[model samples]
Target: MEKIDNIKNEINYYLNKEENVKEEWIEENHPIDIAEALSELDASEINDFTKLLETEDLADIFEESEKDLQIDILKCKSSEEIIEIFSHMAADDITDILGLLPIQKRKELLRHMKQDDALVVKNLLGYDRESAGGIMTTEYLLLSKNLTTTEALNKIKKIAPDTEIIDTIFVADSNKKLVGSVDLRDILSSDDEKKLEELMDDNIIKVSADVDQEIVAQQVAKYDLTVIPVINKSGILIGIITVDDIIDVIEAENTEDLYKMHGVDEEESSDTTLLQSIKSRMPWMFINLATAFLATFTVAMFEDVIAQVAALAAAMPIVAGMGGNAGTQTLSIVIRGIALGEIDFKDNWTLLFKEAMVGVINGAATGLVTGLILYLMYGNYYLGLIIFLAMILNLLVAGMFGFLIPLFLQSLGIDPALASAIFLTTVTDVFGFFVFLGLARGFIVYLI
Candidate 1:
């Protein structure tokens, strides 16, 4: 932590210095590390630093930084400067950055860009940010299907400097609609007399521009493609979603799931301003607080019982707290399974049976320990029996609900992570208290 703080201080100090640094010194560091160092700097300082670098270099730095920070730097720069940066950046990077900007700003930026660049960015921005279109690069090598292998190679050579790579060259018809893809290796090995149609793999796995990015990532991993083409509704090739962009999509999605499972809002970021963080989290905290009061109110219903058997108050919390922890464990698993597409609605019964089995095993183990402790501490077998029964029952309910609630919410078109934790915990707490007290009333009359 101390080392991190010192690094931050050093970066900030350099940013604050009025004098310019040598370009040689900046070039010595990796772009990603430089971007990280610049991340903590003020927007004005970032803008100044950006102006010093070439457009391509600046775009590389912007792409390396966090999405939100990229927006901050773009906001500080002028439209012309932004357009210059956009023109040089890979299409996918431009799309990701554009998605982070407000709608009005995005339009203004689009208006200022060159027509061809603007059209590509506009096409990308049309799709959901988490879709294939938004994550794909419009930088691909393309050749007419009529071209011979040698002709294709010549075309690739002519465009290689401006294009991203020649790993996979797309063959298109006269209308520029995608026909198939040819691997660079196959093209090199093929006779010059062969046409692109002869060398191309017609059974290409392509994604619609509007296909969800998660689904696109799945397809890429499923097919092990180095590049997946993105086409419009009319089957016109628009862009290519590369493995690198898909990696970012997967990481973002996993991060969102992890945060949501912890009852944290998906939008809350460590780099977010304090006010922004508070704004994102305040709603969830408020909702949790309200649900907590409901749990407290349920406990209050048995105040008379608790008063008579003061030991009930002590033991009741143990049952409720344990159930809550167990439920959270199951909740984390189910939520992640859903996000990763590992668990589906069809697997509901399977998950239910598995959780139930876990509940039985865990409850039996926990109950025996609690029962033994209660018998020893209170010198009453009846009280121990009541506690044991209540614990096992509550844990069973916790496990069942933990797996079911998220599945239920998803079916209803609500986000499972929104308040599933609060709801699940509330159920367990209220039910745990009621069962413990009610069971004690019936089975342990002498204790009461």
Candidate 2:
């Protein structure tokens, strides 16, 4: 609370003209800080404050803001000022914001941009939003293989303004095909006469433009690359995906999986309207209510068993609840392994056996304790034995469904993280209730 108030206070001080928000202030503070402040300001104040900010600074703050907030900030700026800000921003980010606008508005916004800049964004907008071409930037420095070390250094200085990072320079042939790459140190260490072809290293890792963003992130992570070049189907370098873009992709994916795991829409934000949140959540809640009926119907099938021995009613829920928790634990591990690409079909047999043994061993241990407790409380040895068998059966069933559900979902081309939990819960709850109640009904005389 204190930190937030302090930031707000600082921003307000500048807004009221009590203190000047200098370039030094913008440079010292983070862009996210400015965005948060802007998010808190009223429409009039937002328009007033944006006029004082430099185009690049305004662009940086917008880049760090949420999509809705970015649109709001843009509404505060004039068309000319907005185009100036776009000129200072990355094409990928500009296209992302523009893509969210109405088609007519999007076309008008692009029409205002420089012809070359607009063309680059138009080409980029053609790619899928989750593809390598979607996230890459055309702003990269490329060197001709024929240039000498000294000549390449001069070319880099000339083109550095348009480049994002020059630490690793990509070298191309006369046909504009990527041949090799070299570190900036490779140029500085070599003699002035050494050509780029002689200094560049081979065996580069590159992704095609059409490849999925997730696969692009994985390759970057696997190879520990700072920037990966994106090539066309014809093997010509078009754009580059930087480490920052991969980081964003990883964060977005994790957020999506997290939301889907718990039955929330990934696109819903903290500022989502209350009615919108309800609309988004209502369908899933209804689905969950229907699943609850499945458990209730299973219990209904053995109502006679529960009526005869009231003690069975007390113990039945314990059995089902335990199975549900156990299934969740196993599926958590399996789901993570699937997302990280750690699980393989070759090791799947081993994995299934391991989980099954875990179920047996854990079931025996837990069943023994729970059965002993029931026996002590109810003073019925037959009741204890019945529960012990039921528990073991349910737990083994839990492990089987938990292990298989995610794989089945994946095979069907569905996200395991989204649907596996719902299926796993239904399996555990239905089977857990059925096994415990059916066994009690069979040994009703002893249970009495």
Candidate 3:
């Protein structure tokens, strides 16, 4: 704690210094640590520090920082300076930074950039920000089929510094359409006189520039590719999405899912302004409040039954709360499975059946204990029987709704994680309360 506080203090001191700090100090500190320190500073202070660093250094820092903080810094920089920094940054990094920027600012930055760079950024921005084009780097080594191994090597040497990676080179047709690929190892090992076409692998798995980023990550993992080529609709090679970029995509996607599960917008980052955080969270909280009231209303409907048999009221929350918990467990697993592409819509019924079976097993175990406890406490077999039946039924319902609600929401093109929790919990609560109260009422005379 003390060490963290010292780091925070030092960061604040440096941020407010209003003088250029030593480059050596900046270089010696870990980029991640510096980013964390910067995160603690105000946006304007971050902007000042960003301007003080070289474009390359700034790009590195920007990439290391959180996405929202990156946007904050971008918002503070001038359009021309932002363009210059983006121009010198890696294509993947530029794409990521641009993704967080406002559309108007992004367009303005593109307008100020070099035509080729601007075209690449514009093409990337054209796709869904969560797609292959948006995450891919436009920097890659390209060779022609006509080139000899020696010629290709020379071309690689000329462009190696400018390209992201020369280890994997793509071979394109005369019209710049991707034809095949060859690794640098094969090129170096082969005869200098051999044509690039002779050494190419035609089975290169390529993703369309507009392909979903999650799909791109899946393909990369499936093929165990180090670098996957990105092509336009016409099959003209535009760029390559590297494994590193895919890793970032995966992490971002996982984080988004986590946020969504908690009823917060996935776009809300830790670095988001307090106002932005409130905006993102308030709607969900309000929705949750409404759903909570619905649960309260369900309980209220049985107020007379509860007033007569106060024990029912005392035990009601336990059944409903347990069902809610079980339902959430099922919901979480299903949602994560869907995000990871492990679950398919075609297999929805199978998943539902599986969850139902799990529910039966869990419900039986939970019901037995509750039934025994009620019988021992009240000495009323009818009350125990009612509680047991209600527990089993509620658990089964919990499982069913938990599995189906997310699937139903997803089918409607809604985010399953965002609204599924409220819906599932409400179902469990209402049904649990209704079953417990209705059974008690039906057996009311026997109990008296």
Candidate 4:
């Protein structure tokens, strides 16, 4: 953190100096660091800092900035400047920035871009922002399968400056259909007369353009690939998704799932305004309150029993709280497994059984300790027995509901992570209270 602060200070210092020094300093630092520093600056400072760098340098920093900051930085530039910056940016990055802008502004900017570049960006913009096609770049090496090693190498050199990745170059047939891929090393080592088709790996791992980003991420991780090709429905090569973009996709998806699991909107962040935060959070807060009331109603049903056995009130929270904790533990694991594609509907029965057994074992262990503690505290044998049995029952409820709720949500075409914990807590709380209190009601004479 201190190092970033130092870098930010240094950038600010250079921005105020002569243009030559500022250009040199910007060139010396990483684009990510410059972007981080720009984020720390005020509006006027960011405007001034942007003016100091050339379009190419600015484009690098622009590509590294967050979507909001990217828009802010663009707001400081003229139409001509923005177009020039767009020219230097990768197509995928340009599409991302444009996607965040209003439709009119996005169309105007695309109008000014070079006709071919605008067409590419427009095509990219047509896909869902969370799909493989949306995160892929058109700027990748594509050599004809008929090209000899020497010809391919020469072609690569000519286009490498505009390409996003050259480590693996894709091959296409005369009909422009993707056929195979060849490593840069393979091309370098092959005989100059050898054909690309002979040297290329015919077996390829690729995804359709419309495939979800999560599935793309899983495939990339499973195959240990640094880059994956994207294809259209006709099996024609369209774009390539590099590892860097995949990393960002993975992070964004994980953050989204985590936020949804906790009943928070993924769009809300610490930097959001008070009103924005309230808007995002109020609905979830109200939903939780409703669930809380349901638990209260369950307790209200057993009010007479609770009144007679005062010890029930004291021991009630322990049952519900422990059950909630246990449910959350199971929910977290199941959600993670689902996200990673480890759990499918075919395995639901086996998975549920395994989790139920876990609940039983954990319940037994925790119930023994809880029973011993209650027995020591009150010197009532039945109180200990009631709590022990209640713990086991409540935890069993926790495990079963936790495992089933997510799968049920998923089968209904809903995101399993969305409010899953909220549902699990409601189930655990209501069931835990009912079981613990009902047991107390049965043994009230002894407990008293």
- For candidate 1, write residues 25-50 as lDDT tens digits: 55766667777777777777777766
Per-residue accuracy of model 4 over 22-111 as CA lDDT, tens digit each: 566666788887788778788878888777777888888899888777878888888888999988888899999998988998989988
Best by lDDT: 4
Error of 3 at 431 (Å): 1.5
Two-way TM-score contest, 1 vs 3, winner: 1
Model 2 residue runs over 4 Å out of place are 1-3, 18-20, 344-347
lDDT of 3: 0.82
Model 1 residue-pair collision total: 0
Q: Could you tell me the TM-score of candidate 2? A: 0.94
RMSD values for the candidates in order, in angstroms, are 3.3, 2.0, 3.3, 1.5
**C-alpha lDDT of candidate 1 relative to the true structure:** 0.81
Query: Order the candidates by lDDT, highest first — what do you get?
Result: 4, 2, 3, 1
Pairs clashing within candidate 1:
none
TM-score each candidate: 0.86, 0.94, 0.86, 0.97
